[model samples]
Target: MEQASSNHTLQAEIDALKASLQQTNSQLEEAQYRLEEANDMIEAIRSGEVDALVVKGEDGHQLYTLKSSNLAYRIFVEQMTTGAATLNRQGTILYCNSRFASILELPLEKVAGSVFCDLAVASEISNCNELMNAAWVHSGLKRELNLITSSGKEVPVLLSLQAMQLEEGLFMSVIVTDLTDQKKQQQLLKEKNIALQEAQETARELNANLEQTVRERTKELYSNQERLSRILETMAEGVEIIDTNGHLTYANLMAQKILGITQSETDDHVYIDPKWQAFHVNGSPLPENEHPMAIAMTSGKSVYDFEIGMQAPDRERFYISINAAPIRDEQGTIIGSIGTFTDVTHRRKSIQQKDDFISVASHELRTPIATLKASLQLLGRMKENPDPVMLHRLIDQSNKSLNKVSVLVNDLLDTKKMSEGQLQLNKTCFSVAVLVNDCCQHIRATGNYEITYEGDKDIMVEADMDKIDQVLVNLVNNAVKYAAASKQIKVRVVREGKFAKINVVDGGPGIPQDRLSNLFERYYRVDTKDNHYSGLGLGLYISAEIIQKHGGKIGVESKLGEGSTFWFTIPLA
Candidate 1:
């Protein structure tokens, strides 16, 4: 039995030894597996796959970050513009970049230990927690929320949460984007849109009123046109409008009168109508293209002060000064031409008369000057050995020449005085008959003609005696010079009403009827049959002025073959 028990104990011991060996084998296997795991972790750390390791220490759990990942990753996380942070499972901040710390208005060290939810806005704490739970389940989740800063101000942020499972612990990475500037931009855009809508409404209102404004303007334009039409009708100058086709579309009253066209005939009238004869100032034919209106239309330029002559049917030729301008559209295209014309007939006639007077005055002055020069030369030659009769003849010739010059000079002076309205008259009571007789005394002494006085001899008048004598002398002289064929001149004075009428009758060739009207005009002279009259044309004009100054009238009566009578009347005493 001792042997068996010992054997059994040995067998039990063997069994125990087997069990021990099995446990040792299991322990060895586990040691080998752990060794493999450690090697793998070391490999992972070396390869920079593991960032940190969690170790249980005497105090608490601690994180030991591997230096293998080094400064590069830390620099990348810290330099991010978006707030970058790592959080623990309990929402406690483990690592935070400067940007993340700046968002919470806290230092980087302070942010690292702080609970992330504590910084969240009180109203959004639940939402943030929900987002965090969702992020833990889904790995990557995005949410928008507000966080309270260190100063208790709310800051809007967009959070991108990404949960990571590590061998040590569960961690979350958060990317925060600031939304304050973006919200401000959205609000500003909304304001601009509202302003644009208001402006569009104002524009619609202006468009609605545009038609009414246009209608009012049209009415005002019509009223102005009517007023302009009335003004055109009353204007002294002629106004005519021509169409592009060169037909007269409109003509004012003065235009029709000047052009000698009736209103009915205006429809057929053109600027270059054949019936309307146009001439230049020099009496040359004016071509159609040279007309003022034609030039204005063709060249689109104004023609001012263009003097043109036209002869209407059964009317005398007349001059007209034309001012023409082209009518244009808004785009400056020539539409037609408008011309204003003024009748310049009297001005033209005066210019011609002035030219003629210059020629005549020069001729008349030369003759007396030559005669006086010759008489003086003769008197000088006979001075050495003087024959009394020859000397007396020369003296008489000089005196007569001087008297002629004096008369010519006096006439020029009197004409200038009358033109300027500076003629001074000395009035006295004088007998008209006596003045006529005395005026004829010199002619009677010459015995060149027989002078007779008729009518009332005692006719008296209030007049400038010298001026009256001058008028009478001029008439008697003209009778003597012009009526040399008939040697009789009758001077008559008569009283009719409150005036005395004097007449100087002659048997000269009567002036033509056509020339009678202008006889009293300045520089007008009657064309005698002989055309040998030596006096200036100013005699009749001066005589008329003198009689007019005495408040009298002067006129002439003549028949083709019945001689001529010149007469004047002044107020009687």
Candidate 2:
């Protein structure tokens, strides 16, 4: 009976174990089905179906993500909690990561659709429409724009504006970051810089006080200052002071005169010394930047006498012998630069005129002396000529040529007197028309060439009779000399409103094209064979000066093959 009861108990125990096993299998099957559903959902979302995966949390009835592997979506969602911004198409506010909204003192909801400009950001893209239009027209562009928040605060943001051809038309993605805190910190630091500046100011004040006391204690200041000030103001040379910033601090009378700048004009003004003062032959700014005497003081390089020239609008080209030295206090620290300059322009001009006179005198004297010598030789060779009349004619021609030489010499002497301010024009009312006819008649008498005249009627002008005669003679002689080989030399005088125009036209070879511009410059001779073979080329220059002195203009017009005309105009009485 005991064995039977034991077997019954064992059977009951086995039956209970089987029931527990079945329950475990059922739970396992349910778990497998749920996992398969989750996998299916993830696959669907990834295969162009949805944006995310949903799952249940560890606690009962709590929801969570079973799997989230979409990095772009993850970043987009995370941006709502971060300061980084994730933008969508059309530049709409897609997502401001939490950190970003915090930077702007705004909520995510308030910032949505705020756009970049709604915030008070002063960015380069204040004109976003123009930029977007350009981008769409061109396809892709990247630029930086400042961001504004709902709180009317501005923040610097680097924006990458991109265009993509999406299935839903054009799309752009803007990635932004806030630099407000950084800028604020920088501003705060910049404000704090006053301490450093004040310290420097204090140091400067202390040094200045110390220098004042030291100079006074030494008892040499009054004497030195008096000497310096007197020398600066009364020195024979001009003087100027330029602060380290290249500002005009002080200018002496001579300096003002040389540069044509008065104290009134240059007071407290930023002065830029002409560039020629700094450049050398090799196109380098002399003494370098640190060598601009004021600069040399800071850099410890010595500067010596420097020569410079400046051209003014008044046609005053001033040449200055310059000396620049560092201006220092008693402590010997460079404060600025003091430059001494003298007006050497007049001196230079005088020297040049002297040189020009010598050159012209020598050149003019050479040919006449040569002709006289040649004539003497020829006359000597013909001393025993068979024809007395022919010999007499030769002597007469030689004498006439000699008379011309003497006249030119006299004219040179007169020019010297005029340059020395001794010659004066005897102003009178004379008829330019009469003078023109006289010149025509004279040219005709001397030369067998056809010389025609126009406007022979008396048209009076205000000029010295001799000066008018001189002008006409020079022009007619030049015409005769140049047109000796031509068929006709025409002199035309016309009365225009308030001025009378005189023209000497020659059908001979016109001036060379290149020689027309410099016809008035002294000693400027054309390289043409005909020009070289003619009388000295002083006629035009002398005529030009005389005409200009009379308030008239002289010019020439000619082409390569066309005949040339020399013309002048004078004011009518």
Candidate 3:
């Protein structure tokens, strides 16, 4: 019995040992399964498949939690105007935003699985791959590349890449910016620069040719002394010869006409005669010693390009550019001097106009460009964490600046067309009243001024409708600008015989009488100390040209203290 009991005890011990072993093995399997589940959860979180993670404590209560940022990141990607995408280490697209798909003109699903390098042009594919490789070492890379769109059109883009290490694998985030508009602007600036260089070269060549011509003519005069009289008579420029004693020896017919001199006065020393009174370019009385002929004779040196205003015998004041050189006889003794005069009143006026145009254009373009630059800089700073309202305001401001730039460009083009006598007119029959009201609507909406209209509602005219509208808008805008304090503007349309008359009347400080006649001149602006007004000063000039082309007229009436009225008359249709 004792042996049997000992055997049973041994068996019971073995069975207990086996049961403990089986329990331990089952616990091990469960632990392994839980570990696998935990790893899967981590992977799901990394892949953005899981949004939240919960941990339970010994009390079966949550101890720690983690939330995914995938939603916020996706929203940010969607909001970006620039294209964004993610690619694998091998340059295969793994993810992409709507903007990226739009740029390629393909569906997002199609783009996500496609090779990024394949989307680039054949010539750019190698470079694209190289750029991707460089991104791994440099952390980021940027390049300009041409991408082939779905339609097979090559589009230029600025591509930027940044390497990212994720739980799943390594990836590269790419940002693509369309370079179409930027390229266009760059091309325009380049063309302008080239044109400017060409113009400068042409001006230099003209000056050189002019100087050479003058030198050649001087040599010819000395070599062919016998034919001097005949040469002087046939020359286009006015020529005169004066002795060293200041007595006039000879004067060509052209010289007589230019100086408004009689046949008898041709023999007199006009330089020393007070009756010939001349003024400096600044309108100061010119001294006899400072005259080109007087200076050349007394100093025995050439005087070139001395511009002065002269009171002709007809009492009319005109500008002349004079060049004089001392003449020497065979013995090398100073004998006399020869002088030539070129009428330069028109040329001086043209130069002044050109200078004014450049000044005005620079000022006009600078303001909008500065505004645009500032807006863009501010927008860039706020892009990462932007307030929706403020972002909208910034965008609106930028749009306004762009519009101003567009308007300035259009005005410049129109001015160029006017200069080339190529300003086209597209005419149509339109009601004058409707046109005037439509033009003023935008200005009136600003609530800065009270606009009043009085006219025959049925008055119709045949003219370039858009051009007329532009003129009307310009007039109203000026009225509002100058009469802001007065706060009132009146527009009137009336029928006078065979013409329809339109007037823009403003209640403001009236223009001076001296400035009235020059109102329609190109680049002419009223002198003002106030900095509120700015423009290229081409509006009135363009308006006048448009009216004249339609066989009409434009004018302004003003009194210093009262008010002003700008009016135009177009032939009735």
What tens digits encode model 1's per-residue C-alpha lDDT throughout 94-148? Answer: 6666777877888766676566877899988988888888898997677888989
Q: Which ten residues in a row have the lowest lDDT in candidate 2?
A: 61-70
Instruction: Give the per-residue Cα lDDT of candidate 2 at 297.
Output: 44
Worst 10 residues of 1 by lDDT: 209-218
**TM-score on alpha carbons, each prediction:** 0.58, 0.40, 0.54
lDDT of each: 0.76, 0.58, 0.74
Q: Rank the candidates by TM-score, best first.
A: 1, 3, 2
Quick one: best TM-score, which candidate? 1
Q: Candidate 2 on 278-318: residue-level lDDT in tens? A: 33323344544633445544653434334445544546345
Question: Candidate 1 at residue 46, lDDT?
Answer: 38
Better of 1 and 2 by TM-score: 1
Top lDDT prediction, candidate number: 1
lDDT of model 1 at residue 415? Answer: 91
The list of candidate 1 runs beyond 4 A from truth reads: 1-227, 328-335, 528-532
